[model samples]
Structure formats: structure tokens, C-alpha cells
Target: MSVAPVLEKCRAEGRAALIGYLPVGFPTVEGSIAAMRVLVDSGVDIIEIGVPYSDPVMDGPVIQDAAVRALAVGVRLSDIFTAAEAVAGAGAGALVMTYWNPVLRYGVERFATDLAAAGGAGLITPDLIPDEAGDWIAAADRHDLDKVFLVAPSSTPERLEAVTAQCRGFVYATAVMGVTGARASVGEAAGALVSRTREHTDLPVCVGLGVSDGDQAAEVGRFADGVIVGSALVRCLTEAATPAEGLTALGVLARDLAAGVGRGRS
Candidate 1:
């Protein structure tokens, strides 16, 4: 399904949807694909496939470790698109999240085209500011790819307005001041951040960062249209000895989180 329609469905249900992230080639290309399939089968609404970069500034230790392992296995931008294609071919909606440096290295227009051809629905570059998004946004728009933007608690009202305007698929509402990981509670700060973003745009808001476990997922789900679990999921994959074992663990966790969101809505 298209990004907008999928988000619309989630909103109509009053339950936040699950968006899972896993660094490509974490275990291996094959392992990543298997994990994605399991996630989809476990009822993930959307999948964010991370493109491994040498320097991932926004990622925490878990994701950083995953990226290091992926890079060691020679996972490049091209390999990420290949894995995305495999996921898309399986009838899953996939989004490619990467650093701008890799896209520039691969050529922005070429990367967008390749991503679209691989059935990617959108692109997310956390470090790409709106002021400098002209070329990348234009390229993504040329290929009908949704350009997802991030809004942190640190953003000013004006900056939030600008980000909301540029965002297409959905706005990723970062719940904490630091990198991605699990937290005990989302707290009032996160709720206020979500409320502030809602004042600017009607786009579906998906809360990420510091969300781990079913309870936190449910908490964010109570206030946002979607909940993104990254570091926690990555931790599961990294701890598993085999890809199959990782997939099983992730699928069970996903289902539990999904159940939490469902219960929250009810």
C-alpha cells in the first residue's frame, strides 16, 4: 500500500501502527530479509530498513554495533537497495533510512531511481536539514518517494512548521534528547512534543527513540498515530546466535507490541 493510505488506515483504527527498523546486513543480507519477512508476517505496518554507514551520529550503541557488523560484511548503499527490493517483492512496504553522505556518494537522482525501482515507498535521512533538502527532496519527489522528516524536542516553532511542510509520508517524532534506545516511560516531555507537532500539521506522527517493550509502545501509541521501535529490536537481533532465532524473537516482540497498541486503543 501507499504510505498515505497505510497511515490513514492506522488513524482510522485509533491504534498506532508498528514500524520496525533493522540495519541491513546486520547478521547478513539473507538474515535481514528473513527478519523482515517475519516482521511483516507478525503484522508490522511498515518497515524501515537502515542503510549502514561508517559514522552513524544519531544511533546509539546497539544500532551502532549492528551497523559496524553490517559494514564489516560489505553492506553498502547498493546492497541496501537490493535487500529493500527483496522485502518489497514480498509485498511489504519498505522505507530506506540512510545518511545523506551515502546518497551523495551514490548520486541522489540515481539513488532515488534505484530505490523506487526496488519498490521503496520513502526515504528518511535524519541528518538532512530542510534548508539543504532541495536536491534530495526534488530527486525523491521525481520518483514519487515520500520524504519523511524528523522533529525533536529541541526544534523551535518556526523550525517545526518548516519540517511539517517538507514532510510527506509521516513525521518521525523523536521522544528523547539523545540517540535511539529503550526508555522506561515516554514522560510528559514526549507528550508535549507530540502535541506541539500536532499544532503544525495533520500528518500522521510516529514516535521513535526511547520506546522499548509493549508498555512503552502502548504509551506512545496512545498519543501518536504510529510507534517506531529500533534499538530494542536491534538488540534482539544482535543477541541471537542465528538469523532464524533473531527473526523469531523479533516477531514475538513485534506481536506483543502490536497487542499493546491495540489494547491502548480499545
Candidate 2:
């Protein structure tokens, strides 16, 4: 379930891959799984199955709200695997996005083992840096799971090189210097950051943060290997009046973003 192949396929087709994010157990566990299936059918190449944590420091209000609701309904760590299994079954690479503390609490080796058994693509640990990820790195390697680390606009040349070296599926390039959310623009520094990251590693650099619509996705796609979207997508569900409406909005936005990514090379 390595995401590299999906990104590679998108590259072969002359576009960047669409990486979508949604928290497990949002609205409901089953509802989230069904929504994720809509995303894949609508055109997301990879799905980042969010593990709803008590404290999501990197998340914006939209994602934070969803996480709170998921937690209120008692979403467990195991729910992440269930969602991942469903997403993988739908034919999209499933990667779990979680905080390092939860993984530590769950036991790094056990988390990795369970994720792999669920056919998850890998882990996108926002707060876990390579310098302190010795245990996770070892566990992920043993489980054959991809390790994705995030690099931001403020990252130093040395920092960028160090981070990208530990990454497998793709390097997550944070377009802005804040928490994750959709913005009018993805920021002017994104392209420069991507260029700087490429200086260190040959891995595909996917940009995230502040990308909301198809235009924004296409804009980021022009210089990125993939476009990572989260808050905007989550909002589709949170802002909708009904469950059916939420799914419909999710599908519409996903399809639009997919079309946007495809226009990147054009």
C-alpha cells in the first residue's frame, strides 16, 4: 500500500496526485468509511485516515471540531485500522495521521504491526521528527510501512535534508507556517520550499496546508508531486445540514480537487 506507486501513476499521466484527509468516526465510524469511499470514487488517489487525538495541535478549527466529535463518540485507536482497511479495500492508499504520543501509548511496534495488517500505506507523524523517531523508524521498517515527515517554510537547509532522508512515501511540505486549514492562497513560499526540499532528496514533494478549492489545488499541483487537502474537506461534512448532504458535498469537492490536480501540468 505504498503511496509512491499512486503518485508515480499520476506523474505518468501528467498530473499530481490528490491526497485527501478525513478523521475516523466522524459523524460516525461507518459514516466516515462511506464518505471515504465516495472520496476514492470521486478521484482521490490517496486517503489520509486521521486518528482522532485528544490534542491535535497541528489541526485547524474544522479538523479540530471533527476530531472532537469523533472523540466524543468514543473513537478508539482500533477504529483507525477499521477505516484504513475500508479505504484500502476501496483501492486508495491508506495512511494514518496520528500524534506521536498516541503511538507511544499504543506501543510503537504494535501500532506499526496493526497498521500493516490493516493494509495501511504508512504513518504521517506531524510531531515526530527523525532525530527522535529511532523506535518508530525501526518499527515501520520492520512492518514495511512508509514514514512521512513534514517540512515547513521555516525549516532550515539542514533540517530539510535530515527530514526528507527519513521519508518514504512522499515528503509533506507545509505551504504556510501555521496550523492546517484552507486559505485563499497556498502562500508564495510554497514553491520555494518545494525547490529547497528537492535539493536534498529525490522523493516526490507533496504540498499541504491552505489549499481549499480546485484552483488552489491546481496552483499547488503546478510545482508539487501531490496536493494534500484536509480542513476544506472536513468542512464539507461539518457544514452540511444532513448526513446525505455531507456525503454529497464531500464528493463534489473531491471531484473538483481531482480535476484541479489533473490541470496542474496543463
Q: List the global CA lDDT of all models.
A: 0.86, 0.94
Off by over 4 Å in 2: none
User: Tens digit of lDDT per residue, candidate 1, span 105-175?
Assistant: 88999988888888888788899987899998898788999899899999899999999999989998898
Task: Name the top TM-score candidate.
Answer: 2
Q: Which pairs clash inside model 2?
A: none
lDDT string for model 2 (191-214, tens) is 999999999999999999999999
TM-score of each: 0.97, 0.99
- Give the clash total for candidate 1: 0
